[model samples]
Target: MPSEPAPPSSSLAERVARLEARQEIEELKYRYLRACDHKDPEAFRACFIREGADIDYGELGTFATVDDLVTLFERIALARHNEGHLVLDMHHGVHPEITFLSSTEATGRWTLRFRQLNLAEETERVLCGDYDDRYVVEDGAWRLAKHHFRSLWSLTRPLPKGYVVDEGAHL
Candidate 1:
């Protein structure tokens, strides 16, 4: 029987392609944050694996798949709809320090800030946090594999009397 053929080594062109793609992923990460602040699911969805991904929220532990994340968001969005608690409601920001782990993987730490009004609690909150994320290149796209969110600080207080929520405050 003939011996099996040897596998081809990674060519220079292949390496260059991988590097270029990784850089593109980094750019996508920044776009993702802005898109999220805009509350555009179409944009947000582009940043994640959308299936078989894991998310860890520290004390809340980890969710095994992207579907879980979607489910939670659905609940939040639905509740917010009734109370007009839409995010992108206030100034929200994410600053990323993304690093390449390999041609197909990377990790990043992000600083995040957002405001939320919890009508059920009759309180408004400003949350500041850091997110540690793992990214994977799958099928030529970068997707979040494990996302860990930790709140570093939070300020909560009552909404001022006669203070009306404005959806365009940040826009």
Candidate 2:
């Protein structure tokens, strides 16, 4: 049986719903940038769908599910506190171009520009990259289904060239 087409008004409502969902997805992306740069793995995990969130960090390829991402984040937490000698305080700014593919699904391409500071090495990489993401609505909230990071241009400078590194600096 052929289904009746949606009413004009219903179509408009659907458009509005998709727009609102896109906004929510964009906010989730922003939080991901903030939490990841801060190395707050717990906060980062909260943005995932809880079932099949995939994080592909370019070289790492792809993680199977959100549980796998959690395992990856556990490693990050341990390393940030134990493994790596380099200390970092970074600020990441995300500007995303978001598209709503459906009321439940969307995609985003985000540009990331960041400033990094290493208290131990006195080095910084002013880095830039693109993040392609897929977001979905689950259990009344938007969560990342998949994320891929592709770095474009990365430049390093000697601590901003004459900028003194104070003790316990936060980029």
Q: Who wins the lDDT comparison?
A: 2
Name the 10 consecutive residues with the lowest summed lDDT in model 2. 1-10
How far is 14's C-alpha from truth in model 2 (Å)?
2.5
Over 1-171, each residue of candidate 1 has an lDDT whose tens digit, in order, gives 101222278676765665576567667766666655565556666678867776887655678776666566545544555536544334344555666656677787878776867665667888888888888978777788878889898898987777666656443
In candidate 2, what are the lDDT values of residues 133-153, reduced to their tens digit?
Answer: 888888888888878888787
Tell me the lDDT of candidate 2: 0.69
| Per-residue lDDT value at 103 in model 1 | 66
TM-score of 1: 0.70
lDDT of 1 at 78: 40
Local error of candidate 2 at residue 102 (angstroms): 1.6
Q: List where candidate 2 sits over 4 angstroms from the true fold.
A: 1-11, 59-61, 65-86, 89-93, 160-171
RMSD of each: 8.3, 6.1
